[model samples]
Target: MDSKIVQVALNGLENILRLGEQESKQNGMGINPYCALIEEAYGLDKIEFLQSHENQEIYQKAFDLIEHYFGVEDDDPSVVPQVDENQQQFVFQQQEAPMEGFQL
Candidate 1:
């Protein structure tokens, strides 16, 4: 896919995740389901890939997402976290139903 497209998708994902995190906290959920979705989708892989993107804005957005979710600095290689074919199917299964309310 085009880098711009990927960047836009990542930005949207980050926004949703950040918003979900805030709302979940307010609701006392203690965990962000959107973070789980990102994990299931191997979001860290995309972050790693985008780190080398020639576009500075893209890399910055990726880094910001990382920092927000992991509470880690950009130089922290340990926190950056993958999916496979079977896992892809499992992710799809989990996403089959749209979330109706604040329930995870």
Candidate 2:
């Protein structure tokens, strides 16, 4: 893909995410529909891949968009932890059968 087109796409996505975030805050909602939709559509993966583009500007814009909207930090723990909704505790270690004995 062209660098210019990629930059434009990233900018547009950033704008949409920003607006969605603002709307979510104003509505006192915990979920941002726009963000959720993007995630569901695997947009996050594409954004991450774009971060490695040859063009510095493209990569930087991708990085900035992710850092600003995703709230990811360099100091974050490496473990892929999941929350135990039932017990309200953090499960840091990976589970082979995380859903074992779990009930809706």
Candidate 3:
């Protein structure tokens, strides 16, 4: 609804992407499928630890960071974060779904 809110959402995605894969290795939280936890992780902001090392190519740690520290699990719905309406606008070329009876 606001720029700060939107920015926080975007930043949260990055933080989850950076942490969830790692958190799963420990705690044995059993890979939550509805990953609203990623958003929960954002509120915690522990992802700040990752900001300095983001450019490195070794993503395993980054993934582990996500999986473990940020409470991400492979089966978690958050693992496949949804593209919000604003994000969908930028990610795909839009063509409306065809109606069943209105074939072109």
* Residue-wise C-alpha lDDT for candidate 2, range 1-104, written one tens digit per residue: 88888888988998899899899999999567797898899998999999889999998998887887776546656665678999999888754877568689
The residue-by-residue lDDT of candidate 1 on 1-104, one tens digit each, is 58789787987888898898998999999788887787788877777788788888888888888778855435644442324576563222243666576666
**Candidate 3 structure quality by residue, lDDT tens digits, 23-65:** 6546586454224564565633444444344344323444544
User: What value does the lDDT take at residue 52 in candidate 1?
Assistant: 81
How many residue pairs in model 3 have overlapping backbones?
20
Best by lDDT: 2
Local lDDT at 72 for model 1: 42
TM-score of each: 0.59, 0.67, 0.24
Whole-model lDDT values for every prediction: 0.75, 0.85, 0.49
- Which segments of model 3 are wrong by more than 4 Å? 26-104
Clashing pairs in 1: none
RMSD to the hidden true structure, all candidates: 15.8, 9.1, 14.4
State residue 59's C-alpha deviation in candidate 2, in Å.
0.5
